[model samples]
Target: MSTPDNNWEDHWRETLADHKASPPSTMDWGGMEELLEAKVAPLSPIKAPISSLEGKTLKLPGLPWPVWAIAIALVLALGYWLGSHTALGVSQEMNTIPKKTSLADALTPPADTIFDTLFSVGANGELTEEIISIERAIVNRTTAQKSPEINTSLPAGKSPSPSTPVNLNREKLKAGSNDIAPSTTPAVLLSEAKAPTTSPEFFTGIRRPDTPSSAPGLSYDLSSKPTVRPNRGGYVRPLKTLSPPTDRELLEQRIKALSLSEKLVITPLRYKNGHFPAYRPRN
Candidate 1:
């Protein structure tokens, strides 16, 4: 009995046997031959005309050398003119501005007066005598003003008592005036003389004497040594003395062992004949 697959194979064989391969009638072989001839033909060589530029160098188009020289000169002249003009303007501005004077210069006496005072011997004595007289006048005026106030403040029936007399020594005043000179005024000297003087410690910093005293009988031995108590706890075990090898040391030892083993072993060479054998590579 013929199966469907066998029947299909037999029908395909008969159909293939009857099939014929014939050329197409519409094909133009003559046109195709002409196109092939055209493609195969060689092209003609192009010829360039020889000119003066063939041997000579081509220059860039720009201004002439003389024109360039003139332009550079003009630029330099303009720069010079600008620089001189700016410098002149700055000088004029500086000259037009006024010079400033300091407070010390304005307050200072004339050079002539300074020269006269420095050279003249009588000037010093006269200045000292004048200062002393001024101080005396000030002291007398202050005392007089205070006396009236004190009397007015007291009861009408009660007589105002005479106040202590102010002592003014010429030698002491002269010494003090000579020592301080122009730095201290007469009023300041009088004030300093009137104010009571005291030790620096009285007004500033901590007062150590004012602190309260310690209790009478309680005494402390600062020089005595401190007592130490005995340890009552159990004895502590000491730490292990042996330390394990680190990873780096282990790896180094492993590498050393591997190197020694590699030296002992004889490995076969890839190309014992000193030349690679030719073989087809697998795709």
Candidate 2:
């Protein structure tokens, strides 16, 4: 119960004072194990692990992934088919427009027998929006189609295939060349033509056909000339003259015709400093 550490220095010091050193304590292995076992007790047994959850109704609300995928696929396929069918029909209808005919027949005047035709827009005929739209579409489409046909109808743009050598069907080219340009040039307008003058031979001796006389307020001479007489003074003819450079004396008469502008262009160059001043050549 009372144990102490043994030191040789304490024994030597205490020997002079007549005191004895205590011996070192020793442990017994068997006795210590006996004391430990006496203090401990055995533990209780462990319970079994949980087996199953408490029972209740379970609801798994869901569509399977495969089913959802099939539904989406069906909807997309249906839309594709409907869109393709509609597009095909539209293309066919677009290709079915009537071909162009000669402009003469198309532009011919409608019969005036009908009241609508008589009141219609002049010799140029009536133009509606629908007609112009259809005409422009036809021209644009035909031009695109013509390029391909020209390429195929004869090896157009081919480097003269060595095997076939583009036997340039000359007869076809010559025959078609006739149709290339328009057959008729469109009408150009000259100044309006004067009405034919009455022939003197046709009226040599016959009485004039109720022609108006210069004087008014007189009786008619139906027996011979058949001149028309009305109540008015006779008209007098005035003399007309243009101060322009007239047709005959255009060059000689400079002062009469030349304006300040004309005097500039046609004025003769005068030599001032022997070098004709600084006239820039018409650049």
lDDT of 1 at 90: 100
lDDT of 2: 0.32
Q: List, residue by residue over 1-283, the lDDT tens digit for candidate 2.
A: 3235657667766787896557543556567778889877665565454424336545655889999899889999999999999999999998897555766445443333121110111112121111112112111111111100111133333332112212222222111122432212011000001111333223222222222111111112223322222222332222223111221132223223322222222223564344556766886
Which residue pairs overlap in candidate 1's backbone?
none
Q: What TM-score does model 2 achieve against the real structure?
A: 0.16
Measured by TM-score, how close is model 1 to the native structure? 0.18
User: What is the per-residue lDDT of model 1 for residues 1-283, given as tens digits with 9 covering 90 to 100?
Assistant: 5798699888898999999978645457777877889888666666566553588777866989999899999999999999999999999999998665875465444333311101001211222111112112111121111100011333345422212122322232222223444225332233334332433323332211101111111111212211211231333332323222322233346445544543422334646466666676989
The parts of candidate 1 lying over 4 Å away from their true place are: 1-70, 89-152, 156-283
